[model samples]
Target: MVNDPHPPLHEYQRSGDYVVGGIVSHAFILADSIDFTIEPPPPSLEEVTVVPKNYQHILALAFAIKEINENPQLLPNVTLGFQIYNSYFTARSTYHATMLLLSKLERFIPNYICEFQHDLIAIIGGLDAQTSLYVATFLDNYKIPQLIYGPAPVMNEKTPGLPFYQMVPKEDVQYMGIRSLLLHFDSDLVTVKGDICTGEEKLENLPGPFFEMSMTGHSYSIYNAVYAVAHALQAMSSGRLHHKAMADGGVLKIQHQQLWQLHHFLRGVSFNNSAGDMVSFDENGELVAGFDIINWVVSSNQSFQRVKVGSVDPQAPPDQAFTISVNAIKWHSWFNQVQPLSVCSESCLPGSRKKVKEGKPFCCYDCIACPEGKIASQKDVNDCFECSAETYPAETQDFCVPKDVSFLSFEEPLGISLTCSAFSFSLITALVLRTFMKHHNTPIVKANNRNLTYTLLVSLLLCFLCAFLFIHRPEKVLCLLRQTAFGLIFSLAVSCVLAKTITVVLAFMATKPGSRMRKWVGKGLATSIVVSCSLIQTGICTVWLATSPPFPDVDQHSMVEEIVLECNEGSVTMFYSVLGYMGFLAIVSFFVAFLARKLPDSFNEAKFITFSMLVFCSVWLSFVPTYLSTKGKYMVAVEVFSILASSAGLLGCIFFPKCYIIVLRPELNNKEQLIRRLY
Candidate 1:
């Protein structure tokens, strides 16, 4: 046991039978220097400074008891008294103060009774956790109720109860608490009209620099703590008086043994305060209350204003728990009008995806755009996906757009040009064939095997018509005939030129003396050449259709934003083989026509045949590289254009002069004029 030589700052007053205990930290100590020696000087007022703000806590306790004593509706017959001690903010002083409340002065014996009628009911603890802990530990054995009127002790579940009870709620409750919640326990202090400040009147004025030394956060808690003890004691005394169950009691008498019963009454106290808010406690002795959400705005003059912005209610459903009205918030001018992005990495926008950074947190990432032909439907997606077969990725890659039906159609500009060219050439070929038929008896028309001429012109007409197969929507029949038909038809036209070349050579030989080549110069030899060369190409197309034929298919990869309805050649080898065969026939005809160009006979036309073959080969030769370089439906257009150009080349090169003579120059149709040109 220790004895103090100097008197400390302490206050005590006896007014009634019941006494309440208080331990408040009214002053703090500052040791100017610590003496490291074994014996140190005792703490005194020379080292201690009183806190002006903390005087309000002790004042709240005094005012609460005064308000209760003056209220007639509450505690009609009972009066309450109190003993307050300055804790000096030290655990040793706090515990020593708690002992004085239990034992009488000059009697150091344990369990000594009070010398007066004042019986200690409960203690309002010191303003700090460590001080309250020391006071509670000393008072627990006696079972006296200790109400903590300070900040709630931060204790975990396994921390074992430190303070006897709680006044404020746990710190974690404020994260999800109600708005505008406080106590009415000390709001009437300013209206108390008389000399209410006691010895601390200098610190009691409102709107002053020290904030009137008013009831702060902890002071409010102290006010509520005092009201709680008063309510519990009144209820306990009233119960005994109303039931008349107190044996040997006229009104209500509280002994040291029955003080523990006040814990039960205080634990069950659930009345609403004057603020219309419930001053209730849960089973764990935590205050059943809430917290208000405030936004701190610092103005230009450095004035701080707290604005109530939003709230979070723990009792509400999860989606509705947190509610905010953004328009109510006022932002500083330096922040700009829009709220700035403050995240480590902003979320990836649409048309891009999140790429996690190596060796970094998950929130830290890089954003990359979606690959071509793919789309991301929402922001922060991990990867982009391809659209359905009938759709394509939009330009932004944020969504999929429906694909347009694409092919070489007659309505579009390219289609209209190809269609007009094909029909114009066919009409020109038909007219030439008709002109030859009407002038069959003439010498120029009868020359160069008229039957072979007719066969060649008719095949060229069909070749021009073949270009229509590449236009419009591709079907099963159209796809089958599109490539193969053009190959076989062009082959017939080339073979006719070959036959006509052979005929001119044989007839030139027959004009020699006693030549046997004249017997092979009739229609039999010409027809055989046409049939044999055409049959070879016909066999190739037959094998193509029988083995790997063309079929209608949609091409999505060839174009970024379209689906081309085209013919997918089943076997690329066979399709090339068909084009190769036509090239071979044209080559053979060009060689034959070139050799016989100088033949002097009047009927020989090998020079015209050579020029037509040259035109045909030039058109198809340039078609290959251009066709390979282009994408989508443009590839089909190139092939169609090649067909039209080559057919027109053969028509113009071979028959333009002949038609000029027959229609415009009638004298050139005579034997004399032909003989003059041939010589």
Candidate 2:
């Protein structure tokens, strides 16, 4: 004997659920087999057989079931195989067969709602119309959904009164086919004469789009039926994931539930068939599709040889026939209208670009073109690029503007390029004038350490002016200009703070009047102090340029958007760098102020400076955590708050005491009196 190569399924399965096509059933192997003889099931007069005494009908049904099961209509991973019980082969034995099958396959069928009774799972054969009708009534009483092959028309109708979906064609579809044939012939006599002459009338009367008897309809019907079943199987397999995840053999449990799920899933599905139009069912469970219409050409032997008629919709009622009229022809005219094209608005002119209008569409304000040397690039651009010193915009009309300056905002939609650039030049001019005026008034600047005080006052003013760069609204050239001015002013402010700290430290260390370091404390020393601070400011600029420094703490993207340059230090980095640098200044200032306590009260300016450092440190230390946590517009709010607070403190520390002394006590302003009181 040849050995079978296929392994036994017993090894693959464990004691668990078997989900097949969405129907789940628990399988268990009995530990003991009971020897029981066949007997009538509590002989109830209520039980009756519905099939006639013809075995061929039973055989045909068996064949159909076998075909459906064996056909490759289910996914290979979850294929269905059928089991059979040969109920005794006679009409009366139909009930006996059901009972016998139930006993044999009790494991496969589910228990009824009434206390663990297995619902009989048996297929009944309908030899004649009576058997099918009887079976339909019987099944209806029991509420079992069954697949029937009975020839009775009543079986195809609502039997259980529950939803009875029929695969069989109804009488209406048959009548519609005949009407479609008359239309396709396009005969003038049929329309005008209204003569239903003999042979054709009988042909028309034959009640067709008959049960799809022809090879064409039969083939499409069978194909679509099997295809639909395959679709159900596919849905069942794919949708059973939640069940499968529960255990290794949860397929059985998933299968039962998903089977009905598969039915609902396929109800509204539409797919292309051999017929051109989509094949689908309407709200009522009926197949309404446009299939080819074929008419009988001649009778051969006993059967009719049907020829092609045309095509028609099977779902449409027969009384209402398909026709084309002038109204139908006129509907085609809609195709003539052309689609409109969208043209982008022209770009902003040389010095201008489009800015998002504050209130209305297509509304914009023209930006002032920086002088002839300046140029703009990009369309509807916010800002124009400035010509550094060498290059210029190629044309007044062209949008691709050029700039001589090597620097460009990393971000494109920057709004403050020109304003920022102008501000930087103004700051430089102011600083130069302030420096020159102090140097030129030699005698006056040298007296009473006035030059150092003048330089510090000028630095503070420059720092305050730099804050405007952050406004950065829509304007050509303002982007670059803003960054330069703000960056330069911030660097200068930091340098001035450092210089003050150094000045205090050095003054305390140089207590000896004849010390060489003391000789270096006049107008020349003040000039050196300014230049040294300027160098520190320059170093800050170099580092900022290399790193693509960030804007003052604000919305993360706002600085980039407004400045057009990417901020190197984002929230966290920005906080640490700012606090670290300021903290260094605070430490130096504190140490210097402590050491300089011995200095004469007249020159005890270090005390006020140290107090200012403490206030500044306290403000920023609190600002860091809040600044880092906030983002976007809220961050802008926090930054604005910080700016206002810092500015207020600085102004108060520098001017409040002097103002109080001057305004409220004018006599205190007298030099001799103030000096006498302090001493």
Please count the clashing residue pairs in each candidate, in the order shown.
0, 29
lDDT of 1 by residue, 549-604 (tens): 99999897777668888898899989888889889988988898899998895744
- Evaluate model 2: give its TM-score: 0.35
> Candidates' lDDT values, in order?
0.69, 0.40
| Structural similarity to truth (TM-score) of each candidate | 0.51, 0.35
Question: How would you encode candidate 2's per-residue C-alpha lDDT over 437-541 as one tens digit per residue?
Answer: 545433222322555555555655655455444443323344334444543544444445546556655554577676666755445654565566556545654
| Residue pair clashes in candidate 1 | none
Top lDDT hit: 1
Model 1's alpha-carbon lDDT is 0.69
Off by over 4 Å in 2: 1-216, 219-448, 472-488, 497-513, 547-579, 662-664
